[model samples]
Target: MTTMTFTRKDPPQWLLDFWKEIDDKTFGKGFDCFAHDAVCNLGVADWHGRDAIRENLRQFIDRGFTAHHDVVEYWDGGSLKVFHGKVRMTFDDPALPVVRPAMAHFFYMDEKDPAKVRRWLGSVGPIEF
Candidate 1:
């Protein structure tokens, strides 16, 4: 697993662990970080609730896609936490070539439950291989 470096303030341990799971190629373990009713918005698809999100994430992870997020900036304004970073992935499949996204941007807007990420909205722009 590659160690990811962040440019700003340190995120909570759980969040860090969550991301670490991905870098470790253990996306299933990563789902433990989300709330049961959380919502995840990928650029091309939106997965609602943890079950759907977990299953969808499993598909790519199972396919051997390694996900890494390198944070360039982060804003934790008490309730709203925003993330902007460079995301890179290794896609072992021939159909979806590996890509280096310009930056991974996301806004975790719901803070009703501090320990769990409730709502996530983000998109990554990729450079074609």
Candidate 2:
């Protein structure tokens, strides 16, 4: 068996780019680039791996949900990068068409080559409207 060697590097720009990709896939309308085992949390649900994550997003898109993220804070400590943000999600559901105050915390590891996100954690709750 071969061991994969990962090096530490600046994470801010790279992580931002990754988030951009996710945005594109979710709202901007693009492809998904996360690894097979990537985990994601989207307010009402939790997903593990790329397929599940894709399905989760696909469900939102199928229901005509669009989202925009407002980044509040960002920190890059070499190998780890953290982003604190909120997302505004709008769907066609007439009764509950919008989801606001959606908070997210993205954790990135091995910034040198971010092919695999070691972990990603996110949550949504009521915030000052």
Candidate 3:
């Protein structure tokens, strides 16, 4: 797995591990980071529950796309955590550009349980495709 570098504050270990699981294409492990009742907003659609979120994420992760996330900023405020990053996505299709600059924002809600995310509001912008 590639090491992630953050420009601002360092993120918690659990968050790092969660991202690692995603980068490693291990949805099962990554989905464990969210609560069973967690909600996820993927910009395109909103998914409720960890199971639904996992399925949505799995579809993208399995779409012949490999990504490397470079975290530019991170914030931790008790029950909330926010992270902004640029993801480098490479596609299997040679016809597509190898590098596309895409930015991602992740807002994690951890009110009741600090260990698990209760809600994840995420968005990826400037999608050229």
Candidate 4:
């Protein structure tokens, strides 16, 4: 089993900038902002790498769905951080007309001296979505 620890510190400015970029890409740019090696679990699918993440985002975009996330809570360690928030997806599905809401957990690991998110783990539900 892998043990994880959480710490509270100020996140680097670049990380925050990355989040903003992701938001813009998903909502405004109609593209994906996650890295190629990003791991995503959103109760529907489990994806790894930037390619896989991008494909998943592409699928969403193809379906005319917009993914949005609000960071309700965050904990930052020097090399690691955890973010918790609500994720909502709004799509043009006539059957499912409302935004789907779920709890989101994001784990980020900083790589090298630049402190970029080398690895990201996200869980959205009991299943890998």
For each of the candidates, the C-alpha root-mean-square deviation to the true structure, in angstroms, is: 7.2, 6.8, 6.7, 4.7
Candidate number achieving the greatest lDDT relative to the actual structure? 3
Candidate 4, number of clashes:
9
Q: How close to the true structure is residue 51 of candidate 1, measured as C-alpha lDDT?
A: 81
TM-score of each: 0.72, 0.58, 0.82, 0.59
Clashing pairs in 2: none
TM-score of 4: 0.59
**Considering TM-score, where higher is better, how would the candidates rank from best to worst?**
3, 1, 4, 2
Instruction: Give Cα distance to truth, residue 40, candidate 2, Å.
Output: 2.8
What C-alpha lDDT do the candidate models reach, one value each?
A: 0.68, 0.58, 0.74, 0.55
> Which regions of candidate 4 fall more than 4 Å away from where they truly are?
1-48, 125-129
Q: Candidate 4 local accuracy as lDDT?
A: 0.55
lDDT of 3 at 17: 72
Per-residue error (Å), model 3, residue 95: 2.2
